[model samples]
Structure formats: C-alpha cells, structure tokens
Target: MPETPEIPDIPAQIPALREDPETEGTQDAAGTVSGEDGDRGTAEPEAEHGDAGFDLGEPGFDHSAPVVAESLVPESVRQVAARATLPFQAARADLSFGTAFWYNDLIETGGDHEVIRQYLVTATSRTLFEIGQWTLRGDLTDPEQPVDELVMGGFAKRWKVLEGLGVAVMPTVELHLHAERKGWRWDTQEITDGLAAQADDIAAIGAEPMPAYILGHEADDSGRSAHPDRTQRLLAGEVCRPAPDAPLTWSDPLPTGFDGAPVFAALPLPDEQLKLLCLGVALPGEGGPDAPATVVAFADLRPAIHALAPHRRRHWWQRG
Candidate 1:
C-alpha cells in the first residue's frame, strides 16, 4: 500500500528504431551500414540481403511461401536459433517464432529469463494485491460486485499464481498420500461435511459453491497421539469439540463414516460470511523450532476478510 502510485503508461510499441528507409532509418557520418566505406547499397552485396528487410524483419515464416529447407527458414529464425544456442538466459526475447506472446510483448528484446521471471512474479503479485485491496474497499468500478465476492476472486487469482509455479491442487489426494506416508489416514466424511456447510454459507452470500476439505496428518510413530487413538475418530457423526477459545463453539455427538481416522471439519462462520472453523480434534500441521505439535486453535475468517463489508467504499476511486 505504501508504494501505491499513479499507474505508469505502458508503451504498445517496441523502442527499437525502425530499419525502413521510408520510416525513420537514419544516415550517419558518411551514410554507411556500420559507418565503414563503399557504396552503401553494394558495400557487401550479400549484406544487402540483411539491410533490405525491416529492422525487426518479418513476423515468422509464411507457410504459403515456397520452401527449400535453406529458404524454408527465415533469417530471423536463423539469428534467433544462433542466439538461443548461447544459453537460455541469453536467448532473444523477440524471436517472433515460438516466443510466448506476453513475454515477447511485455519483456524487452534480449531480456534475461531469470530477470523476466522475477519481473513476472513481482508484476503478478502486485496486480493481484491491488485487486484484492480495491475489492476489499468496494471501490471497484462495478459497485454491484460486492466486496465479499473478492475473496473468491482473490482465491482464483492466487490459484493462477500457484499454477504458474507448477503447484497442483491436490487437497484430498495430498492429504491421503501424506497420511499414508506418515502412517496415518484421513477422516474424509468429517472433513467433507464441514466444507459442505461452509459452501452453503458462501452460496448464501451470492458466491459460487467452494467445497473445502481438510488436508492434514494422521498419527504416526513419531508420537503415539500422531495416530488415531481409536478407529471411531475416523468415522462421521463422532463427537466434535472446539479449542477452548474458538468462536462459534459446538459439539457433534454423532458423526459420519469411519471410526479410527483423526479429523478436522470446515464449518461456516455466521452472517453469511462463510469460513472454516476447526470442529474436530485434528489440527493443521505447523512448522516449529523442535518437532511441531498438533494443537487446536480457533479458526476465524482473515481480519481482512471480515473488514470487507463496511470498508469497501474507501476503495471507490470516485464517489457518486
């Protein structure tokens, strides 16, 4: 928020000077290609082939053009191929062929990929954060698009960032695999019902249904409690308790399905502001100085989320 400044205008055109003589091509210090000598047109007859085209050259090869393997490839392609052979970072950003359109347009020609990656990550993060901040402020262009809706929107944008980093969404599968690997099992029914309840609340807020699931650990040899104390813990309709300080406290004497699985459920928050509250004994994995312990804590909506309803008008760029 401190860095909020006027958005800079992005130039649609490349900065490089045009090679077309009819355009902006300039004659310098005696009118030669490299400023050497000779008839500029025939200084080196073969070099004319190079200077005869646009500085950036044509956009990729036209398949309709006649092809001899030698002629099949355009001069730009040959130059790009030579450059790509240097190293990935040294590759040209404006190869025209096989280049990512956004990368080609947004990134400068011959830009380093490592730099480009960092640029992309930063740009995308800033863009999403601004959108989130604006959405929370309810200053968005469309006032009818409620502030609460931004949570789902933010989630979607964040998911795109995760995907770009090659992260897969494996809520259920990840929990099962991790539990099995750590010698534990997931209480799916308990988790699913909790999420289903949250989904209903979110739907009531005019948000699309977002079914949630608990991705957590099972008991293991690391500690006796790491595993289920009894098979009944894995089943549904079992007693559900809350951490002493948690809000919206409730207990379910009966649960659904399995008996031995340690579980947690996603429960809805009040006032149509749906969120996951811890319902069962199992808690999320925590990183710690020593071995992390699974301790129950109250689950509440993020403070930013709760701040949505009343403060949205602050983000409105212009007031009616």
Candidate 2:
C-alpha cells in the first residue's frame, strides 16, 4: 500500500459558532436538523430540516450498535431493518435523492441521479461545492445525541472496476461528528479545510444468512417527499456472482431515488473484513427494468475514502 498524505487536522473543539435556531433538532420522534451554510448560488429549494442519513427515526435504537436478530416486519423497512441500513435524503434542482453512510462518507451516485451526480462528479476536490444549496433534507435524531450524522461537504471521485470495464463516479460527502461538539454549524472555509482530503466488483461469499439487503426511502414522486417519514423501500439479494464489468443487480426493481444505498455482503463477516470488495453502493434506479445497480467496488474507494477523511460512526470506526 502507498503512504497516505496528511491533510489538514481538525481539532475536536467547536468554533464559537451557534447552530441556526430554526434548524434545531425537532422534538423526540421527528429528530432532524440542518447546520447553516453559505449560499452555493443555486436556486434549488433548500432542505428545511435535512435528513443527513438518520437512524430510521427509531428513538431507542443506536446506529452505532451492532445489527440485532430479526424483528417482525412492519409498515416500512424501518421496523425489521438494522439502523445502519437506513438512509437520509438529498437533492439539487429540486430533484430528490437518497444517500447513506457506507463505510464512512455520505455517498450518492450520479448514474441514476444525473443532476447532482453530475455536479458532484464535476465538482472540484478539497473545495466547497455549493456549501449552502443543501445536499440533504428529511425529518430528523435520537435524544442521546444533539445532531444527526451529516455530510458537512462533498466532492467528486471516480473508481475503476477491477476488471477495467468502466469507471464509477460518485459525489461523496463528509459526515459531521455526531457527538455534542458543535451543533452542525461550519463555514465553507472550515469545511473545505477539513475536506483537505479527500468500488466494485463483487462479494466472494461463502453463503451467509442474507447476503445483502437494499434499504432506502423511495419518494411518492419526483418531489422526494416521504411526508410521514415511513415509506416503501427497495429490497433484494445481491448477484452472488457477477461479470467483472457488469453492474451489480438484484431480482427486485431498484426503485427511483435508491442512489447511495449501501450493500454489505454478509459473508457473515465484519464490515472491515473486506473493506476492499464486500462493500457496495446502489445505483439509483427508476422502477421498471431499472439500470443494473452497482457493486461500487470499494477496492479503490478505500484509498480515496481515507484520503478525504470522512467521519465514521463511532462503533463502525472503533470496531468494523
């Protein structure tokens, strides 16, 4: 492995900045909030109380905790699902999208979400890309913590499949620290300085219980509104074996707004065991014959993920 470069160092201290009063975390059940950022110069409607990939609105659940044994299915995936599988929302041009913390960063692919995906792939690295236009929006957080996990900033990155078929373009963001440090308030320069940093193929599994599961909130329309929070989700198993160049696919349709959903090939192993290959991000899809979803193949992403220095959930970071 090559030596990783040292970017800017972010201290654990929060600036004298106070969070936006209006964006404060909601009461108990609707735990959500957004940190104030500069105007990214885009006319897109801003996320009132952003999602920031929260823990599926379950009050007592801990995202950092390990996945528990199966629970009975309910209204939505929120009940039967593990906290890690749940994702928040993001959008640009008033276009809605879903993104989650896979490994460490807030990832959303451009393949299905052309607008923001294109912006993310083309956006400059180590700099603020629309620090304000708003990247996430959904009802948000647990009472134990102040703010939910947030993508403080985002940048463009590309990864070539091990087979060399094509490249995967992604707009990945840095999740702000969830601890009670700062209430999610940081200027563009502050975020950029922190970003100073900064897929594919398949799972070689030996057959575990459920190889993988797709979890995300698909909107009722392009408006990306899941009004009540609990909505339908796209669920399926992984293509245990896929062609080197082929994008990962599943039997179930990859519903619209499924971008950036994480897939963990449960070789019944740990998330870090194969940070190189077992991890994958879903390609956004529109119901019918949805494009072949992705395996994101983190082979190359691991390096970039570390280079950029995105925040990792305390449990995943400490253990996985």
Candidate 3:
C-alpha cells in the first residue's frame, strides 16, 4: 500500500500552535493567507478548538466597537451645550432678574407659625442642604455647572437688584466643594426681616420679601459607574448658573378666596407653564396702588441663584 500521509492532530496542537505566531499559519506548501476552513497553512483556519484572532467580534465580545457614552452625555448636558453656543447676553446692573404683580388685601389675622416653620423646614431641610453640597462638591462634577466667575458675576448683579428693592443687605453666599450633589441656597431671616421692616420701601418696589431660593440636585451616580470609559472630566472650581425654575413670580392679577379673603391667584406664565409663588406680606390696610397683594411671575431666576453666592461665585466643579 502507498505510504499514507499523517493528518497532524490540529485539535491537539491548537493550544501550543496558537501561542507560536511564526509557526501558527497552516501551509499548503505555498505560504499565504487563505479564508479556506480546512487549509492547514492558512493560520490553522482559526483553530477550531479556539478562535485565531482575539474575540474582537464574537457575539458580545467586541472589544473595539465604538463606545457610545450614554451616561457621560445626559439630557442636561445637551441643554447646557446648547446654551454655550448662544452669546451670554450682557447682563444689566439694574435690570430686575424678576418682576411681580399685586392685588389689594389685608394681612391674614395672624401668621401661621406652623405653616411657615413647616415650609422653612421642607424648603430648606438638611437633606436638601446635603444634596446641594454633594452636587456642587462631589467628584463627578456636572457639565451644566455654571463656573464660579459666572456664578459670582451673576450673583453680584442680582444682589444689587435686591439691594435696590430694599431687601436685606447682601447675605453671605458660599460654595460647597466636594460632587454627587451641587447647588445654591441661603438664609433669608436677616434679608427677609430687613425687607419686612422696610415695608414702605418694599411696597415701593411693588413686592414683599420671599424666600430667596432653594435649589438642589442629585447627580446620577449610576452614570459615574459602569461607564468609566465614557466619563467627562470637569475642571475643579466653583461654577454658577441660574437657579432651576428660578426668577420667582407672584403675578396672579386676579385673587380668589381660599378661607374668606381673596386668595392669591398665580396666573399661568406667558407660556402658561409655571406655578405662582405667593409670599405673604404684611401690607398697610390701604394697599399700595402700584403694589397689590397678589403673586408675581416673571422669568428672571438669576437673582435667587445669585443670592446664594453674593459677589463671589459659589460654583465649584471637581473631578475624580
């Protein structure tokens, strides 16, 4: 019988052959890359027992596919990015960041301490404070964060407005540096009391002292994890931006009755998409002609945000 050619045990040799790139290729006497499955010299035809190339494209094993950053780029980021394209309008010094509307009504018999306290507690709770700090100080900074200079600049401008409105003198605004949370908040006792004392001055401005602002945010930590490859590197420093849903309003020209007296009516915004912020003001029995006793609404929220930081921007951005 003619000599029979031995079929080298490819399965058995796969492990060792795969490790040796030089000797890994199967040859048909003439060495060349071939797509043939059974070509011994053609890179061992991917070695049936194991893949020839890295499993760069084996089912869910593609190591080189373009990674889409869903977490690094959130909807908020898109909003901010859009803003960056627009020229930040040159801010005016006296331009009120907000406007107010008023109707006539006497102060409620007595202030509801419980309601005020509860509102204060709920509005400025420790939880909100902690969350704000985290958002501003956390390692993973938010991209939409307004820069410190921008925050301080905007704040200084707004503080001047409050000063013009006869509210309390500029209150201290501080930026907490740390990143899972970030925002601006303030103490209105001194400021609010100041405004209350100056009822005449406030009436001149056609409004009463309301809570400056209570903005908070909780960073999506899930985005920080599981997508380290696609995280954004924010610079370290304070960033400022207009407070969310800011530039409070009180313009419900028409007042309704809740218990007895006319209740403050919060008119729908021009876009008819906002709530009315009705702050109780102790007005003289003879209401101010220009300033009625009703809620006000406008689109300037920068004041409230600025009140949280004063002349110095409280925007802090940090990266881990």
Top-TM-score candidate index: 2
**In model 1, where do residues sit more than 4 Å from their true spots?**
1-215, 222-237, 241-281, 284-320
TM agreement with the true structure for every prediction? 0.18, 0.43, 0.17
lDDT of each: 0.20, 0.32, 0.19
Sort the candidates on lDDT, descending order.
Answer: 2, 1, 3
2 versus 3: better TM-score goes to: 2
* Tens digits of per-residue lDDT for model 1, 129-175: 21121111122112222222111122113212222211111011111
In candidate 3, what are the lDDT values of residues 1-320, reduced to their tens digit? 22211111121112222222432223222112111111112122112323323222321122111222333322322222211110011123221111111111111112211000000111111111101111112221233443321222222222212222222111111111111113322111111111111122223222233322111121222333321121122111111112332322323211111000111111223453422221222111123423332211211112332233212122346222
Ranking by TM-score: 2, 1, 3
The local lDDT score (0 to 100) that residue 83 gets in candidate 2 is 38
Q: What is the lDDT of residue 270 in candidate 3?
A: 41
Top-scoring candidate (lDDT): 2
lDDT of 3: 0.19
